[model samples]
Target: MTRTTALVIAVAMTFTAACGGGDDAAPETTAAPAASPTTAAAEPDDATDDAVTDDAVSDEGTNDDPANGATDEVAGDDPPTEEPAGDDSSTDDSPVADPEPADGFSWRAPADGEPILIGMVNTEGVPGLDFPEMRTDLDRAVAYLNDHGGLGGRPIVMEHCRAAGSPDSSQECAQSLTGKGVDMVLLGLDIFPGYTTFSAAGVPVFGALPILRSDYSADAQFVTGGNLTTMGVIAAIAVEHIGAQSVGIVSADNIGANTSETDLTNALTAAGIDYVSIKGGDNETDAGFQALIREAAAGDPDLLVSLYSDAGCIGAMRGRALLGIDTPAISTAICAGSDVLDVVGDDAAGWMFVGVGESDDSMASIEFEAMLDDGSGDGASGAGLGALAVTMIGTLARVANMLAADGVAVDGDAIAAVMASGDAPGSFPNGETIHCGVVAAFPSVCGFSLPVGYYTDDGDVATLPGFDSVSAIDYLP
Candidate 1:
């Protein structure tokens, strides 16, 4: 399954868990079929296998009621209530406060004000790669932002357009959004290499995750670091935290995957760690996956890394478990989804991922949960793999705050100016500040820092210690 599908499944599973009263039942154990050592040595080469397609690695990129469309407004519109100083009793005429949750995040309602339109372009309707959940999350985030004092007290109006995973379609969507006179644009994970459409139209574009190479360098686009930068962080963690002397990498045999592998190899070599890499088809068979893992394990490397798609991740985990290999493993956050957990079961317990921030406990995470509680974002029982929705919400809030603080009119030109002036607002979920154009090659990557985390059998994540510094690894192209 693709990451997008994994997210949909995860949201559905979250609802199931919630309906089941958050039970902590353990997954049933099953005996996996053992693989022979000869099977590993006789694995077919990926270079000549046409059957192994790159569907899983293709970057085509959940959901509450599953039926409630993005048009529905979130609940609560009252301002945040303040407690009386040194007094417990409330006045008979005083307005009643909203009940606080056990997690301690105070909820507030969207402010009443003029609407500011923000455009969004996402890939949807393409076979095996639609992301309607992203639009839904954006809608929920806008509603929440409006309740909590939206852009200078102006409510946000979202104008959305869908692309069919093609450059022409992406360009058309950009035009459609611009025609609506949107103040700015938010991009979802699109493989379409047409960011220039937005830049040429003079609209400032930002996204939770960057997928294409153009997205990393476009002057008008900004994104939280995508797979490339995340790989660098992973390399740093392997050498620093895991104390890995040697690393083995398995990635899809695609252009994007190739670029990621090269960057990761550079980072590892720079850190003085020896490494070996193998490429496999994006939709590798179970035997293909086993061969890749066995080859990596044969080296007795301290760390085994998987940069494949969601399904590939599942294949790797299963392969590892079947072989009874216990070498510590790490992968991108794409692997930490519900589908993978459901498939791999206990095998996912110690699999670590490079993430943007600490999970569940960070200030940003607390705010993210509060927004979800107020009927914003996906409203899943737990924050899933990517945290894309949370990243989008936090990024937009910072942009809105920057505009508010400067008394600048909310418009494409003004927003672009604010971003270019290097006065971008707010830190990442990990409390790391973002300065656009920090790296000359990847100019649009606003934040370079990342946190590490491992998965729990319950589909939750536990944070690990690693490189949190943008300067820890060099990311020059």
Candidate 2:
């Protein structure tokens, strides 16, 4: 393949974890890039396969009443007391009436207020991996926040540093931002996180998602959990929703991929579900993919999970179709991309997904899309990791607003404390309820719940009933 083609494929590989693990994911404690992931299946030359087999053993408040769409109290909670009917009269009542409902946040910046410096570090300018859209979308989100309410009337000034796909580069960016006295640092697809640097400098760190294994155990905080959480949730879905006793997982054979696979296996074992795993490389031929699928289905498991992304997604789907294996399958949101759908076509039907949700026309959605359009010149769209960056900024603004409303200073330490203490509000834009520090191994994953959905015959996504906001904290390692 040409250099440009290889780079393009690499970008697509990074779009989702191509093989249970991320194509661009670096090992923990190191920032070295992995081999470039391929977008096309190579022609099968040999017929040799390696397999490893192992067998192993929500929200606060009321639960969702599926019958009436109402909240049901927990089994042991005291029942709410009912007031007397038609008790409109009151003794010694004032002339005040109830206040009007709020439309939305309308906090405006104070006159000539000081700017709060928020540091950001993102990977960019790398040969096969670049994500400037992350910074662009975050800038727009900050702009939106400034226009609405500038972090308790103190305008936010973003201090952006670019990392060139290496640990040294990431460290340099962290040092530069810390030297500037930034309040806290936000990470965007940074392979080598500088948590120690920020912690030593007494600066809090926040990121959209935990991309590396080090991120899971880092002192820093992340709003979204990547492979670790996603896989765990998928395992939850397999047991709770699909009612599958046996699950077969097909994954790529990479360090990151194996780590994620182990997470799924552990979750399954904890849930008392049987699971089998099959592995392959990023560049598998059509026949090779079919062979892997056939092997995974050999045991006639109740569910099949494909942890492939990019071209791997297409290969898995096509392999299932070619083999006529109609067993219900599950995959990640990476496979839900338009590029994959356009190629997989109807073959993607009956495939449930983790980390994928149906689109809505809610006001929040409209506002988010509008922000993306408003900053189109800066490549501000909801493709790739741009929307995630925006989510990070919005989440920060939300915590700051909450703190300010309570007469607390809108500083990095306070925000970080609230997040670490699990008192932060719902994630911005989507408002997914989050619980931080719930999983000991994944203390940084504040947003542990994920929306589960499936692809339709027309390639449209739809949410699975009773699977919305599935939490993986119980299954996390």
Candidate 3:
């Protein structure tokens, strides 16, 4: 079974009470089921409230619906998840040559014998908007992946392409990665045309950005973080957890935020969760935030979800504060900058935004920290970096793992075979790693999402103000 199916089972067992209706012009955050009898039962409870303390990837254990592979179980329609863009239909499926351990697609000296090579690709130079420490952390993490025994004991030969924000550049980058004789395409950033080209060339790629355009095709070419469906699932979770009856959605028109908005709306509808929606409310500066505040407040949503970068996203935050709105905001990694939270100050106190790591998650934390200490293997590094860091490294690991599973000599067929076995169990560098097929289907994303961490107090920075995060539960799932 897929994650979606498992989520349905989970929901069937847990939240059937909330299945009725009522609309009282309630705040968006205070979702109501139209005053129906089912509304009272489906209402949020203290136990569920207690479960919201951390944001690391929880649901670590199994659910009754075990068909969705292992560990992808999520809550039902009361929510969901996004991916990428591309025409991946007509690609050449040629096998590539893995050269010696040094050049592109070359293998490394084995611990006990010969060498094997796995090809990886990265798109360099997309802007970073997450944390101050994330960019460098990502660079270091990739290097660390190389330093350790590459994938499956093979040294990874990587080709890096630069789109430089231009279509021509993106195409050039794609061609360059393809030309390097890679078994698979790895991504730093992605371009739709470039993505289609590579897919047409028969290269299976993985990316940090959710860019997969094909979801149902058995022969689709690329894999992304997820599809738009996952975003919907996440939104449902947010509405249910935040007790949100209304929500406002906005984006700054990047690959990240574009996918975020679509899925958010879908999730709301999936769970019958109502929302007041908007667009491009960058939450960066005071002015931008102020404008977003005007737009968001008109609908009287108790909750806000900003899907832009820091600069613009902060603007939305400022606008809300200036208007004296107490709506709790929920944002994605891109919009969840410390600056936005800082500017919001006391109002930012209870505001919740999603992050990839947890403050007190001991199990996954121990594994991630071990990789950091050991300098990280062909594993996902920077889990504790910013949200983007976790995402980027996770993507990298997915690509590397794909190459290894298909062996040094791989083609589109081999690569797809490895990826199509979505969520196949593996001891990945991250807490638990799973492969997602063709990026289109978004097999297990929702069932495996992280949570929101708070910043320090009203006066300081970060999600926690009164206690030192180093000593607190800094890794929670």
117, model 1: CA deviation in Å? 1.1
Instruction: Tell me the tens digit of each residue's lDDT in model 1 across 297-350.
Output: 788988888877568878988888788887778776556555566677777755
TM-score of candidate 3 against the unseen true structure = 0.56
List candidate 1 segments past 4 Å from native. Answer: 1-109, 193-197, 356-358, 361-363, 370-386, 420-423, 456-460, 466-477
- 1-477 per-residue lDDT for model 3 (tens digits): 110000010110000000000111222233221111010000011112122221111121233232211111211110001111121334588554433221111122222212322233332333431122332333333334444334444343333333333455556666665665556654433333365676777776544333334322322322223324234324543444455676776556544455455556766766566776665422345665566667866887656766554455456556666787766665543333334444555554434434322222222232233223322333222222222332344334444445655564433345445545654323122222335532333442212233323333322222212111111011111
Mind sharing the TM-score for model 1? 0.74
Order the candidates by TM-score, highest first — what do you get? 2, 1, 3
Question: What is the lDDT for 364 in model 2?
Answer: 42
Worst 10 residues of 2 by lDDT: 32-41
Q: Can you give the TM-score per candidate against the true fold? A: 0.74, 0.75, 0.56
> Tens digit of lDDT per residue, candidate 2, span 170-211?
777778888889888888767676788999999999877766
Q: Which segments of candidate 3 are over 4 A away from where they belong? A: 1-139, 193-202, 212-230, 250-260, 279-288, 339-346, 359-416, 426-448, 456-477
Best by lDDT: 2
Model 2 clash pairs? 18-309, 21-257, 57-269
